[model samples]
Target: MVPEAEFTSYYGRPIVKPSPWEADIPAYLFAGGLAAGSSLIAAGADVTGRPVLRRAGRLAALGALSISMAALVHDLGKPSRFTNMLRTAKPTSPMSVGTWILSMYGPFAGLAAAAEVTSLLPEQVRSRGPLRLVGLLGRPAGLVAAVCAPPVAAYTAVLLSDTATPSWHSAYKELPFVFVGSASAAAAGVGMIAAPTHETGPVRRMAAAGALLELAMEQRMERSMGVTAEPLHHGKAGRLMRAAKVLTAAGAAGTLVAGRSRALAAASGAALVLGSACTRFGVFEAGQESAKDPKYTVVPQRERLEREGPVRYQP
Candidate 1:
């Protein structure tokens, strides 16, 4: 019997070109999710009268967003390239929509953080005109950021899945959930780390909920993706994914019994943050690896064709 033929591409090159993005892109993805999650936490804390948690969440949102934008600009090799994306709006384009979301979110997040900072000013300075105005606007700004948070957290997944990359495209159904959950967990981590232990009840709940959602979505994605999921289970991507699962699970469990111990809360918070980062990096690497291997691209097409049969042209 003849052996099944091996799939090969021209000159042994990848069937699909891997994205030119570097490590900065993954950092950008992680930071963006962190910012979105933090904004939501901040808004919730504000409504619930958790001043310490509010301040921490707002500050973390702004800081993470700044890092995210900077990483994106650095990856693009020019700040102008980012701004250029804003010159036109394309409803069908995920990149365009994501850019617009970031543009709207940044100012609100910054304003919220700035308002939070005004409280840090000396009493006399804080009581002054401009600072007082900023402080007064804080609630509104934070609310706006919260309103935009879900889209910001999920848009990166949309952007990735919209790409031609086999792993990302194949996992589109669950990628957004994974990203949003990761964002929430990371944001909850920030609150746990920075807020008073007494004020962390909501944050702990959020952490548990987010971690569970992320874990479930990721498992579903892998199961549904078939061969495309292989990249997520091997090499550097596999290592990162394994670390992410362990850390996220540990962090969620720790939050259940963290109680009033600041050390335990902080440690658990750190684990969640690290786990979220690992997840982003792992997903990014898996997509890159999948794109590099022709089998990932060609086999999926072949299977789809086999399952659906060939398209017929109409007269």
Candidate 2:
């Protein structure tokens, strides 16, 4: 059993405050990851001549990207000032980097999806001069989007873990893997729903690998945090986390046995998507809970002070 931490604060008030941002932040996180990972899937399908999967992947990437942008702007209070995010390029600023990544990713992803959509149009429509150019530019634009996808998918973890929040900051080491795995799983889930059964082999494999990686990394993250991990496993956040784990496990198992049955594939894919959503929400909620508890802030500081034998006074 993990040792319980006890610490005091003024009037029993929380030392660290929870985020002011609402659910939209976590929703953006999920959508951004889904878009990034789906772009990668589209790139792979494009290279392998899987047109059906490629189209599906491109469309998913575009849709998710749109949702992510909407959620981000909505969370910013003054939506008109959302463009201020692009005012400066600071290497030390995760938000700045993430904004730049999105700026590049959104257009490329949109172009890719547009290209796919144009290709499916009737001959008379597709043969138009402007449309032909878009079709020609689509593959390269998508490839460029895919190149940026990994960072887009992984950067949110850095953004969250770099914050002052105890639970998120403490789990920094493992958070990237967790986020990437969840993103991959979500993208694969979208593929399963949108692509033909025969072209979904890669999607299924990615889903399984992603789920396993997320589960393993999450377990290690919680265990290593010890008492600090309590927020992740208790109360409302805990419930969501538990549900995510169950769904992820079930989805992974179903993918393995889904075979050629489109129905099973669809079900497993849906589960993985929901599981990934749960994970994002759970992580956000856990960080909030940890921030709101004085023990989470004070106990860690006390432990550090004790371990370091107190700061020596320079006389």
Candidate 3:
């Protein structure tokens, strides 16, 4: 019968514990997904006889996946416990799915990179048939990873939404789009940096799509939040989103103007990369902000418990 506001903080703790995940984890996730997608795109381009674009795509996939895997392991509660994620597939848990997705993605990406780096190796070290075989087999790894990447990138949104994180759960529809956009931008950035200007057309196109999508979703998320939106209005989340918008805009504009200038394309690519990072940071910070305020968690749950009754643990 009493008001829930009277009980502030969890166990008298003023701050909600941010997930054990470090700041790098989300960025890594973004980068990894983008890489995987790029690899698939590269393969497609190569098959279609777009040799220059193909190389760029492969490079992007490799570099992005490397950073993503590193960040992922670094975020584990017990880095040694990483294997447990693959112990079994649990549809109810996105983390478990992500683990397996990463598991398959790692080796596949490594092999593909080795295939692409034939020139980087010494004459003796340069592999031909076997390496090409690996490339052929591993070529799909990026797209394969891409299939799982969206879930890996956005499932965190669901995870936090289900928890006490403020507007995150309420804005579930927009989370996937936000993550997808960020991932695409990150991959396109890598492509722009590694490939020649003539080959970066796809990267530019993908980055523009991503930037526009993220900007639209973010604006909508802000407007849709109502009371829960306040977390995004102040502090780090606000700053990050604001910065992301500006950077995304700059990158998009630069990509349009870069034409065949590899250097200009590279700069635009860099801007997109920064923009993606900012978006990840902003989302995480927003979750933290939602968790920090007692009202955000308490009010909603209190309403649910009152209307539907406290969930009984039968087991």
Candidate 4:
């Protein structure tokens, strides 16, 4: 019997197109997730009467949101054109839904942070009618931000998965949860760094939970991709993912022992933040690599055809 013929491509070019989004888009995704998770944690802190945690969370959410916005605009390349994105509301479009979510959440996140900062003013200043009004509005604004946070954090995964990108689309079922874990870890890291030691119990627990979820989901995601996962473990992307795992493990361990030590908390928090960033960049880079290699796209389709057989089209 003759052996199966080897695969070939036209002039060595990729059969599947790479994503048009550049590095800025992934950076925005990381920052936006951090903002959403932090907003949720801040609201929880407020509800639980953790003043220090509430303040830290609010500030972290605001700062990350700001950075995320900037990254998105930079990716757009034309700042003035950004407003055009909001002109239309299309339910079927993930980008449109995301734009609307950001529009709704950004103001609340900003106002909530502003209100917190305002509350820190002198008693005499806070007693002013305008300031008092702002203080009264802060709680509701924060609550609104919290309500919108989950969608903001999760929708980016949908956006990536909706694309024709092989690695991302293939891992759709697991990517959202992976992002959730990273987001939770990042937000918890911020709280650990900024909240008082005694007030960080919730943050520590969150860090642990997020780290575990991220690690587990990431492993399953890679394994489920089969040969398509090769790009994830081979080169620059692999190094980043490996480093992320190490940092995540170390940070999780440190959280266990940090207790009331500010130094240890800072170290652990930094590691978590870096690990989350590495995960985002690594995933983005892996998708690009997978697109560049035709085998990732063609082989998977071939396997599906072999297993299920070609569909019969109606005459």
Which residue pairs show collisions in model 3? none
Task: Give the per-residue lDDT of model 4 (tens digit) for 8-84.
Answer: 57998888889888989889999999999999989999999998899888989999999998999998888776789
TM-score of each: 0.98, 0.95, 0.82, 0.95
List candidate 3 stretches off by more than 4 Å. Answer: 1-17, 119-129, 135-153, 299-315
Residue ranges of candidate 1 with Cα displaced over 4 Å: none
Model 4 gets an lDDT of 0.90
In terms of lDDT, the best-performing candidate is 1
Prediction 3 TM-score vs. true: 0.82
lDDT of 2 by residue, 39-151 (tens): 99999999999998999899999999999989999888776666887888999989999889889888999999999999999989998999999999999999999999999
Can you write out model 1's per-residue Cα lDDT over 165-191, one digit (the tens) per residue? 999999999999999999999999989
lDDT, candidates in the order shown: 0.96, 0.92, 0.71, 0.90
The number of residue pairs in model 3 that clash at the backbone is: 0
Stretch of 10 with least lDDT, candidate 2:
4-13
Off by over 4 Å in 2: 1-6, 312-315
lDDT of 1 at 4: 95
Ranking by lDDT: 1, 2, 4, 3
Candidate 1 vs. true structure, TM-score: 0.98
